[model samples]
Target: MLGTATDAYQPVERRLGITRRIVEVLAETGHPFSVVTKSAGIERELDLIAPMAAQGLVSVYLSVTTLDNELARILEPRAAAPARRLRAIRALAEAGVPVGVSVSPIIPFINEPELERIVEAAVAAGASSAFSIPLRLPWEVNPLFQDWLQRHFPDRAERVMARLRDMRGGQDNDARFGTRMTGEGVWAELLRARLHRVARKHGLRTERRPVELALFQRPSKPSAQGSLF
Candidate 1:
């Protein structure tokens, strides 16, 4: 919930300790929350997170798209390296925090080939759950992705887009509520099946563990008056 839709641990937020401050407030208020991030920076909050995790109030998911260092560097230049993410998973799990992996935006002929490998690596590093979403190129992202694809994978750029279209019902993206997150058609079904099998084999759940809401305590309002010396 923290970083899947929008990364709260972005470079600037991390540098300013914004995300950490948020976590501090959550911890103080006993509010349960989940963190999804591709940054290894989450490790820095283990002191606060570990205790909450002990009460089933928190969980973490690390997004890892590929295991190949070179490919990862080019694809997610700003994110942490694949190996470092695995380490983060291990660190979280060892501290008794329930951790998972999100192999999101699975691009065909690109990171898709390494889906199982990425999950396996995460499991080995102590991940207990996993999930993924196919790549979606909506609006401006479609052209931008195409341009990048042509530049980096000119040889298979067309093929890749063609296959994605196959999954998206002949379009670059399907914005339908039911089908948007999980695409339709043969290719999408195949991806779903593959992920299910691998997740089962690794004893990893395909869904995130639910956090406890019963422990939530409403944060008290701050005083209107300034402190007097």
Candidate 2:
């Protein structure tokens, strides 16, 4: 995810190039693939994606976050980059850029309020769809997130951790395929339901439209170039 994408790169274009290469590989895998342009600002993103978008390209734009600290804004995210993520939507739409929104790391009691606002902004920006994942704290993310919570949200920190444990089958994570991306428990089910309700209210469908590959015919054998040995 690119928060200070344009702001903190030795050669920012190179960063996008690296990301594009990975996307190209996934696109060739013969499976339905998804691409999320992890970016903070839509303005800089346009300079990166406008040329990459062909007549019909499938992609999503997920404005990501992991902290609720205002101090971190100064150190990163940069106060100059307006907090309005819909700007990313509008710019991409104006350029005919296919788009959607991803509101991830939906930390409990922290950025949950962002859920509705993010959906509303995407709809207003002409987004065709939307998706979400509750806060996933795997690897060092759990401890790191806990530290962030204690620092920025000390009073409600205990409640947050409690809810997380409940969702994880009494663990921080269940570490299973179906249960990994989404934790398991009453609260987890509620979160998933809430996301669906909001998404439906906003006209964002989670069911992706199937791609029509019947039109993809192999190019006529290059006419053999009519070449002789």
Candidate 3:
């Protein structure tokens, strides 16, 4: 998988073409892979991806945090706009790629309110699956995110942190394996239930699509060259 925990299609990748090269190699080798990103820039690879997708060799997930343009700008300033991402979802789905939507890092009282709406919009744009994760403030991100909240959402910053702590066992962050991804409190349970309900209502799968590993071909080793004495 690509861009599952870290985005492979960042803006810099456009100029570097590293992700593109990786996709080319995977396509050439008939390896099945999945990608997740918030950038519509992935559309640039449709030529290679669309073909692999035809053989069920590739799938893509677009992460749409919020639909409000202003909120999206402040939240994910560098990523593609919500509308552009929806367009990319449509394009990928139209090309037969198994496209999904991730309304992730759900910040309570922020973008959380739009969970249902975002899933509904993505479904309308051809997404076949959906998933979400509550906001995680790991390591130094805890303080940094708090500062950000104080700056951008001063009026509700305290409330936001208070609710987040309630979900994090009265702490700023929890790094436990199982509970890290999905919080363990009543709020977290409610978030999970809400997502599951909405996903079912829209006929979207909440689980990820399994990639076909049997199709992966091991690349041949390069022949050793004789050294010139």
Q: Per-residue lDDT tens digits of candidate 2, residues 143-203?
A: 9778877887899999888888888888876678898777888988888888788888977
In model 3, the worst 10-residue window by lDDT is 220-229
Residue 60 error, candidate 2, Å: 1.7
lDDT of 1 by residue, 1-229 (tens): 6885678778887569988988998998899999989999999999999999999999999999999999988898998999999999999999999999999989999999999999999999999999999999988899999998998899999999999999999999999999999999999999999999999897889976998889876566533452231
- What's model 3's overall lDDT? 0.90
Order of candidate numbers by TM-score, starting with the best: 1, 3, 2
Q: Who wins the TM-score comparison? A: 1
Error of 3 at 108 (Å): 0.5
- Model 1 C-alpha lDDT versus the unseen true structure: 0.91
* CA deviation > 4 Å runs, candidate 2: 1-16, 20-33, 40-55, 64-84, 208-229
Runs in model 3 deviating more than 4 A are 220-229
Choose 1 or 2, whichever is better by lDDT.
1
